[model samples]
Target chain A: MAEMRREWIVNAVLAMALLIVPLVALWINEPFYVTLATRVAILALAGVGLNLALGLGGMVSFGHAAYFGLGGYVAGIMAHHAFTGLPMWIGVTGSNQMLWIWLWAALLSGFLALIIGALSLRTSGIFFIMITLAFAQMIFYFTLSWPAYGGEDGLPIFVRNQFPGLNTMRPWDMFILSYGVLMLALVFFAMLRAARFGAALMAIRQNPDRAAAVGISPFGVKLAAFVLSGMITGLAGAMMADLTRFVSPAMIAWQMSGELIVIIILGGVGRLFGPVAGAAILVAFEVIFGGITEHWQFFLGLILLGVVLFARGGLIGLLAGRARHG
Target chain B: MSVALFAEQLLNGVQFGLMLFLMAAGLTLVFGVMGLINLAHGSLYMIGAFVCAAAAAAFGSFWLGLIAGLAAAAAAGALIELTVIRRLYDRDHLDQVLATFALILILSEGVRMIFGPFPLYLSVPDLLRGTVDLGITRYSLYRLALIGIGIAVAIGLWLLIAKTRLGIQIRAGESDREMIAALGVNIRWLYTVVFALGAALAGMAGALVGAIQSVQVGMGEPVLILAFVVIVIGGIGSIKGAMVGALLVGVIDTMGRFLLPRIFAAFLDPAQAMGVGAALASMLIYLLMALVLILRPRGLFPAHG
Candidate 1:
């Protein structure tokens, strides 16, 4: 119980730090820092999505990037059609509205998750990992070869899509939007974690047979979690596309999937704010180390190796002590 | 396509499958023996190609480079097993995946730091450079040699597994790690040897394929994913499964690419067909994998069952 309070405190600090850093940067006319904070928020949203499945549900999906990339394509393709005044298949014209884009991204990725999870959840252990990866690679290659929306070159959003009231052209506004979504997702994750469904999901993760014996269908719970997870990540992907104003197959690459897992592991698996902390640290490392040398990834790799080998609890775990449940 | 072209494509598929077998063999063996999924296996492949390319350039002998590449990969494999992977044996798959993924980032960036970002080219040995004539078609001698080598390795592996004492221990280890240890087998040494052997195979494939494809920083990744597909289809931890799966994936993939565009051209406009064909062709093996999963959830051969 004390550990829980400590974790709450840590989460509060992380949230404040995320918001305050960007606000400070905005005050000082440092738009670069605001952009970095936005990257952290957007990536944290994606990581939070994966955490629902990976941390709580014990499905180590190595293909969440499929949804992420799908979401990006959703945004990119929609924006492209809107700009060109062309109808998307069946005369469905595109909308420049971010809300519409987010809804479609969530729905499309959720549907995709249903299909992929249905197939992938049929296998467990290493087979699940590989199958998920294979599915993502299929999508990645498809995007690379399909030239309608710019193919390997990727499609650029010449202008950021519109929100109802804010001017997203300003870096601070974009950060606010991303951070707002991230906070909402975090709250949703917290509520879910405390819910009956979350308990069943975690129970299934701990032991499938036991979970099934208790009248909880492991597959159903896992599949639901996977779809929800994919939807959240997909929403992040759409937001990421808006933040970067571009969408490419690289977003769907296996490395991105790996990185998402990395973020979760770095922050502390299953912890509510793990993704937030993980994203902050990862982006900070990228900016700081990336400035120091061309081979910043080498150092990043070394740090990750250290974390996996010795400090398995990750940054959140390190600060708040081992997880209460664990 | 003409009969000659078709025949040539068949051989190409077979050759590609054989190369995939080399990678899948190591991957499956490691999984079967240690129950560890090493994502850095591809990095070892990259290491093999880089070392072979560098050595061949320095020594002016492809044979010397091949030997060096094999040794480097094996040694690196042994080193990592001793240092890092040794710890992950008891951990969950997620840790193993993350640790190995980190290894890739380190190795890739380390290689980039040392070799720079540009790709290095490896030339086929003089003895295997030219084309060889068969009745149906002429093919590159090097490619034909690769097929021959793949066959030889498969046979050699079969004999080692079936007839040799180490093979007995390996088969035992796969079924029961604790039992093998209790039987007085130096399980630790056996694991190192197995890992090194697998690494050598991956390295050899890298060195061999490096001749055809440029030796680059991220070359092993695509092949690694393909190997994952092969092993998943074959049945994890089964060598025979790896062979069958590798051949199936390689042939299907190559044929898909070769035939799909032309097939689509018949129905769709030429340009649209080319684009659609290329996209579908790229996804062909993954589709095959999904089909295999649907039919045999545990793969063609379930190692445990």
Candidate 2:
């Protein structure tokens, strides 16, 4: 119980820091710092998405980038058509409303996850990892070859998508919107972790046979978790595309998927604020060490190796102690 | 397509498949024996290419470079096994994946630091350069040599695994690790040897391929993923499966790219057909993999049973 209280305090501090730092940057007129904070929030949201499956549900999906990239494409394609005043298909037109794009991004990625998860969940262990990877590669290659929307070059959104009463063109406004979504996602993640479904999902993750014996249908629970996980990550992708003002196949690359996993592991799997901490640390490392030398990734690799070998519990684990449950 | 064109494409497919087999064989061997999925296996491939390119340039001998590439990869593999991978054998797949991924960042950056950002060039040996006249059509001599080398390696691997005393120990180790150790077969040494052996094959493939393609940093990543796809389709830990899967992926991928656009053009406009067919062609191997998994979840050849 003491540990629980400590964790909550840590989470609260992390959340406040994420918001206040960006606000401070905006007040100081440092748009670059604001952009960096926005990146942390958005990436943390994506990490939160993966945390649902990886930490809580024990599905180490290596292909979350597929959903992330798919969401970006959704945002990019819609904004592209809206800007050009062109029809998307036959009767359908493009939408520049952030809300509509978010809905479609979530829905489409959720649907994709349904199919991929259904197929992938059939296998477990290393097979599951590779299959997820292969599926993501399938999407990556498709996007690379299909030249309609820039192909390998990628698509760009000339104007930021509109939000109600907010000029998203301003970096501060965009940071506010991103930060708000991240907070909502963190709340949703916390709620889901405490829900009946989360318990069943975590139960299945611990022991599938026992989970099945308890009449909780392992397949159904995992599939649902996977879909929800993909949807959250997808939402992050949409926001990321908007933040960058461009969408490319690089978004779907395997490295992006790897980075997402790295974030979850670095933050502390299953911990609520793990993603937020991981993203902040990762970005900080990139900026700090990157400024030092061209070969900063070498040091980054060494640190990650140390983390995997010695610090399995990640940053949160180091600070808050082992997870309360399991 | 004309018969000659078809024949040429088929040979290209075979050649590509053969190279893939070289990569998959080592990958499967490592997985079969160690139960470790080394993402850094691809880094070994890159090392082979870079070292071979550098050696060839220094010595002005492709043959010397090939040998040097193989030795360097094998040595690197053994070193990594002793320091990093040995610890990971008892760990779960997730840890193995991350550790090896970290190794990739380290190794790739290390190589870049030495080799700089630009790609290195490796020309084909004089003996393998130029075209050869087959009965049906002319083909690149270097490609034909690659096909020959691939077949030879496959046969040699089969013989080694089936006939040699070391092969018996390897088979035993795969089926029962503790048993082999208990039998005083020196399991630790065996693992290092196997890792080096696998790394050598990957390196050889990289060196050979480097002669044809530009040798650059991150070059092995695409091949690595494809090799993963190959091993998955072939069934993990099965060399025969790796060979078959490699061939299937290589042929289907090459032929799909070659034929899909023309097939689409039969009905759709050429421009649209080209775009659509190219997209589908790129996805064709993965679709094949998905279908295979649906039909046989454990892959075509489950190693255990």
Candidate 3:
């Protein structure tokens, strides 16, 4: 019980720090820090999306960036058309509304995940990893080929899209929006972990044959988790596109997928706040080391190697305790 | 297409397939023997190309450079295996993936720091630069030499794996690591040897390719991706599958590029045809992969019983 309390304390402190650091930055007139915090929150959201599959479900998808890039493309393509006053298809025009845009992004990514998951779930282990990666590469190449939408150069958003009451152009507002969404995602992730379906997913992860013996369909459960995971990632991608005001094939690239995995492993794979801690560490490293040298990634790789080899539990694990399930 | 053009593209496809086989061979061998999903295999390929280019430039001898590339890559492979990969033999696939992925970042950046950001040129040797005529068409001898090298390597590998005692130990290790170790085979040294061998092959492919294109950091990733597709289509841990799959992918990709544009031109406006055809052609390999996966989920040749 005492150990559990410590874990809770660590989790609370991490969450509060995430919130307070940005607010302090805003107060100190360091808007750049606020932007950094926003990046952490948005990336954390994407990581959480992946954690759903990787952590809880034991599905190590190397292509969450597909859903992520799709989400960003949705935002970029919509805003681009909106700016040009052009129709997206036959009769539908582009939307600048965040609510509608987020909904569509989730839907599209979920749909793609369904198709990809159906095919990929047929295989297990290394084959699954390669197939997910290959599918992402397919999307990456598709975007690169379409010269109409900026091709490899990527598309840019001239203006930030609107929210119901917030002025998203302001740095703090965007940060706040991203934080709120991240918090909501955390709550949803926690609920799913506690829910019955989460149990089924976990069961499948632990032992598929046993899960089958219990009458739970392993394929269905995994597929559902994959879609939900993709949707969350897609929503995060949409916000990320808004934060950067740009979307390119880079968003969907395999490197993006690798980065997402790095953050999850850096923080704590299954922990609720793992993404938050990871994104914080990653962005912090990027800032500090980036300022020091052009080859910051070399050091990042070294540190990451150390963590994977020695530091198994990540930041949350180091601070809190062994992961609950682990 | 003219008969000459058709023949030329056919040879190009075969040549491209051979290059892919070098990469796939290594990847499949490693996965089959070690159960390691190495993302940094591509980085080793990059290392080979860089070393080959730098050595050839310094010594002014391409042949000497090739020898240096193979040796350096093999040494680097053994070093990495001893230092990092040996620990990961027991870890899950995710850890292996992440560790190798990190290796790629470190190695690529390390190479960039050493060689700078620009690509280095590695010209084909003078002896292999001339064109060769075969019936209706002429093709570059350098490319044909690459094809010959790939075939020679393939046969050499087959003999090495099928005819040697080390090959028997390797095959035994693949099916049962403990049994081989129990039989007094040095499992540790065997793994190192296997890894080094795989790395050497990938490096050789990189050195060959570097003569045609500029040697640069991150050059191995695309080939690595394609190699992954090849192994998946061929079957993980199956050398025969890798070779067959490589050829199929190579031929299909080359032919798609050559034919798709013409097919589109026949039906669409000339200007539109070129654009749409190029786009579709670029995606043809992936589409083929997806189609194959749908039909054969375990791939065309799964190795395990």
Candidate 4:
């Protein structure tokens, strides 16, 4: 196919995969698959958030799981307190359930981003990566030790928190909530990419000193991108907690953060739909091979190594030939 | 816990530090010589423990198993260097991190698939199993023995690198990779050999530590983090830094964990004290790391010059 036609084909295929597949899965006789797809959607949303900082901004944060987990704990704690009859101070009429949970998740995650990014942004290169990882470890260890929550055992959501006119306890309702969040996150990603701030962020990633030479403050640009990236991951965490009806210290674990990076790579690094595609592949592999073999991670590792070694641009890069385009 | 308890903990801290040295020596050596970070160094450790455990079980000989484990791990390291890792020398750190991360996943799962998820135990050899009655206190003979072994290894490694022709080539490579290659040393062999040596050291650590702790999949991860911390504190490419940093971190971390709860209990209730104390203890080394980086970004013993 010609270049333009091939690009169109790639975009259409992705849309169909992202949109049509989930809807089809929802319609199918299997309730299990819809729920599975919803998990993918939520995880993909988290990855989309990560892709902003990592793929575009060139910040490989191994600490995003902190935001994702913290967002979860926020919702989990709020619901726990609310269920236990603690009166929330602000009594806005519509801000009763899911929206408030998500809003607070975004805000708290952003706040975390501000603190973590501020300290970490001081260092560059491998120092930055290790610092971020260490900070996340700090949070993880804190959660594990803090006994107010379930500690290592994790906190369970006995009743799915209420959403007006929606029975969120039901899997279908939960899937819709997660899918909606994923779509909104994707739109946010696209808009940010097109925005001038996004261009500036990209420029910072390419060469901060040079970008500064051109009068762009790399510091503020990176900080903004980090905050936005963190907030989105945070929202995904909230959704994840809702899906699982539980929150654990593991959500903030380095493994989760590393896995998020993995998804971006598997799909095709820096592509808009890369995270979604990557999440799809990972979740699908988990669902299928997990049933057949108990040790599927080994195979996943092999594939990942192959991708890193040979498929430098990732799956989408191979399919679309967007190296020069980028 | 009395002064004696503190003393024991100190010794434990030293023992742990020695173990960390064994782990970090190879890692630092490989990284120092070739600016490539190998995330799978932990996997090599895991491989060592697994091999030793399996071999010991089959042969009813712990010493033989340990030798087999070391050799297997070293061989695997060499193979990996030749097949996959050597190519990654020129690649960026992010690429290296990802690829190595992938290897960890593969290794842990592979071990699990083969050996099952159950943790394996390797009994200590007859000579090293008992405790030694020191003048001041009783100590695990094996632990003391490990300290001796670590010191010996450190000396041997120093001599090898400082005295031997191969060691000179490695030193030359570290100083200048392109120039060393131009001078007719087989750079690839140096890398493969260094990688193998590192893998062997890691395997030794795993086998030794496996005597103390159960051998399980993903066991290498925590050690890997600490090794990273060690390298960071000591300086990325310095052997001396790894040694010093490992000891400092081991002592500080152990002391912090043991002492913090007591400090906190004076100010708060027992329950809150434990929680706060543990959290602070966990954060201490990291806090130290941040402070060190702030003061000296190249690390405490950077070999950059």
> Which lDDT tens digits does candidate 2 get at residues A136-166?
9899999999999999999999998999999
The i-RMS of every model, in angstroms, reads 0.6, 0.7, 0.9, 1.5
The candidate, 1 or 4, that scores higher on lDDT is 1
Interface quality of candidate 2 as DockQ: 0.83
lDDT of 2 by residue, B134-240 (tens): 98999999999999999999999999999999899999988999988998999999999999999999999999999999999898888988998998899999999
Error of 3 at B33 (Å): 1.0
Q: What residue runs in model 2 are displaced by over 4 Å at the alpha carbon? A: none
What tier of docking accuracy does candidate 3 attain? medium
| Candidate 3 lDDT, B14-108, residue by residue in tens | 99999999999988888888899989999889988999999999999999899998888888899999999999999999999999999999999
Each model's Cα RMSD: 0.7, 1.0, 1.1, 2.7
Off by over 4 Å in 4: A1-9, A86-96
Q: List the residue pairs that clash in candidate 4.
A: none
User: Mind listing the fnat for each candidate?
Assistant: 0.84, 0.73, 0.62, 0.53
| Minimal lDDT window, size 10, model 3 chain A | A317-326
Provide the DockQ value for model 3.
0.78
Interface RMSD of 1: 0.6
Residue range with the least summed lDDT across 10 consecutive positions in model 2 chain B: B296-305
